[model samples]
Target: MKKLSLLLPIAAIPVLVFADNKQMTTVTYLDRGNLQLVATEEPSSFARQITENTPNQDRRHTLENYINSLLKANAIYNHKEGKENPRLIYQIHANNEGTIIATRSEQGKYGVQIGNRSLPVYGINYDLQSDCSWQEQLCWVFYPSSNHQKERWLEISYAPHAIAELKEGVSLLIRNLQK
Candidate 1:
């Protein structure tokens, strides 16, 4: 019994880690009017764990709804209605750490804005050092300046691209809320 108890914990370690992986979900939202999109990329294993371990379907649904609501409330999904035609939006791909992998724009109006926008906008790119960095391994969000050929806004630690956009959009939306 004593030996069995010691082995049990060791055996449980992999299970615990696997359980943790299952709770991750990837979500993506697009705002055509604002030309913005937010996406969360969770490992497949993690997402499966979350779905399987959720107590009930209602709880799972609620969680998904909440995430969707957050995306829309933050203007990540083009809150404006009745617009005849909106531009394609940028995409926000996030990993488990909430770090955005990339911000890709479809070839269209959205692509043009991404290329032409003069103001500072949130973006993700790789950090290259003396050591070679693989594309998949490098991910970050920073403000890219238009005036300078090689200028970057202060780069902070990894954060979800959607959350970052939501933070900025929420303030703007609040001002318009009363109106």
Candidate 2:
């Protein structure tokens, strides 16, 4: 009974955060080392198709390598903070059925219908839970948690599209890199 009490709340985290809402959007850790969206209800065939269209590990590695190359670049990174690493960390998910689903969004942030469902999105944007921004175009932004040790990524919705955002931001970083 004692151990059971301690284990209950930990197990209930996802349920408490997700079940309260009628819409169920689930993300799981894919075997390929990425996060994949799992439909809480019956997955739409379109969503399944979108999932099928996602890039394989080999291609994904190539993209990651390219992104890594850009990190040292001038305009794209924020080097003022003294921490030189600013890399693209993606949490890919599909926008199945085109319905706006709030996976873990709270009340204030954006990124509802704007998320990159066409492919894996860069990040998400919920209200105060915002770990991302449109203007800054930073995803996987580490927001410190209670312990100040662990952090959560802010989800931001970028304009045009996730891909365009990447290209534009990279260019902006390069163009502004000299500044």
- lDDT (Cα atoms) of all candidates against the true structure: 0.32, 0.33
Q: Which candidate is the best by lDDT?
A: 2
Q: List the residue pairs that clash in candidate 1.
A: 21-46, 22-46, 22-49, 22-50, 23-50, 31-78
Off by over 4 Å in 1: 1-85, 102-165, 168-179
lDDT of 1 by residue, 62-118 (tens): 334333344333222222533333233333323333233333332353344443222
lDDT of 1: 0.32
TM-score of 2: 0.19
Per-candidate TM-scores read 0.20, 0.19
- Candidate 2: residue 74 Cα off by (Å): 8.1
